[model samples]
Target: MMADDGGCGRCCFSFVLTSGLSALFLWLSLRTYKPSLFIQDLYVPGLNSRNNHTIFFQLTLRNQMKDKGVGYANISLSFLYNSTLLVANHTLPAFYQGHAKTAHRKDSVNAAALPWPPSNGTVSFRVRAATRVRSKIMLWFTKSHALVVAADVEVGASGEKVKKKSIKLKSGVADPGSRWLRMGVANAMLFAVFIF
Candidate 1:
């Protein structure tokens, strides 16, 4: 009886171990990450009082996932002067981006909408972008998720962004639903730990 009991205990331990590893693998394989966005470059000649009436910019979109793909809908971009005055608008074509890929979009926009010239050899601007993203897992795609991100741009006497490094755009506000979902995930992870 003692020998049989030892064998049974070993079998149970192996079963639990296999189950835990399988769960971990599934969690890792199915995880998703939202793509990252950044303002790679910005040049506003109007800010420098150059009478150029043009804005040149470079935008960077990155999909950092190692295995999954990202599909973006038409991306709407807007530039606001002094955080309120609309200065320019543009739409970027939608496309599928592969994992670990980065896309750079460059454009020159007419800055006829500038309300006024900058003061003190400096200016403030807001860059906003909105898009819908879908995650491609295996052969299937997930439902579209709305993403809105914005960044503040400070232009100096040179009429270019004050920051030399790329400025990462971030979601301006968090919705209640996503906050609750994150909390729920944390709780579920704790429960799983207790079970294991």
Candidate 2:
């Protein structure tokens, strides 16, 4: 009977230990936030012409983590025509975004002075924004993240309606060096648990 009781106690202890470690790993995975950029709106203010024109738009930065915020190091915007012609470039001011919050900034790109004029009937161009960000969790841990947001739009002649298209650029999350460390720690813990 004593041997049976000892075996039961060990089983209970192992179950509780596994449960606790699993919970910790799950919480850590769910609590971290990934930064994202969005182009909310883009439109031309006046008629398209050979002369210079300004493109007006709103850009939104989002922080979805409930406990973490992001600090921007640099944000840049560029406009391209036919994927090769550079139309305009602008550097936006840096700003901080709070947890579960979003910030919007209004900016314009002047493309009128392009050396190559827009093709006569319809003109299509791409707008892209790239940003470098630092995310902080509880003021103790920080990681760097980078992302790009882009969209394409085509404008018809003076009387034609503009059809805006989805952004075709593909980007991935920028995981900081600490992210690898965290992953390694998690993997080690998992291996140790399973081995023992």
State the lDDT of candidate 1 residue by residue for 103-170, as single tens digits. 89998778654555545567777999999988899899977788899999988877889999999989
My TM-score estimates for the predictions, one after another, are 0.79, 0.70
Q: In each prediction, how many residue pairs overlap at the backbone (N, C-alpha, C within less than 3 A)?
A: 0, 2
Backbone clash pairs in model 2 (N, Cα, C under 3 Å; residues 3+ apart or in different chains), count: 2
Question: Candidate 2, 148: how far from true, in Å?
Answer: 3.0
Clashing pairs in 2: 52-112, 53-112
**After superposing candidate 2, which stretches have Cα over 4 Å from the reference?**
1-23, 26-31, 45-47, 115-120, 156-190
Query: Which candidate wins on TM-score?
Result: 1
Tens digits of per-residue lDDT, candidate 2, 1-196, equal 9999999989977987787688667656645555656656666534454554776767767777777778887788887764567777888998888878988888877764654334446566677778777776666546556767666656555512264432343355444545765876787688668756
Clashes of 1: 0
Alpha carbon lDDT at 35, candidate 2: 66
lDDT of 1 at 160: 85
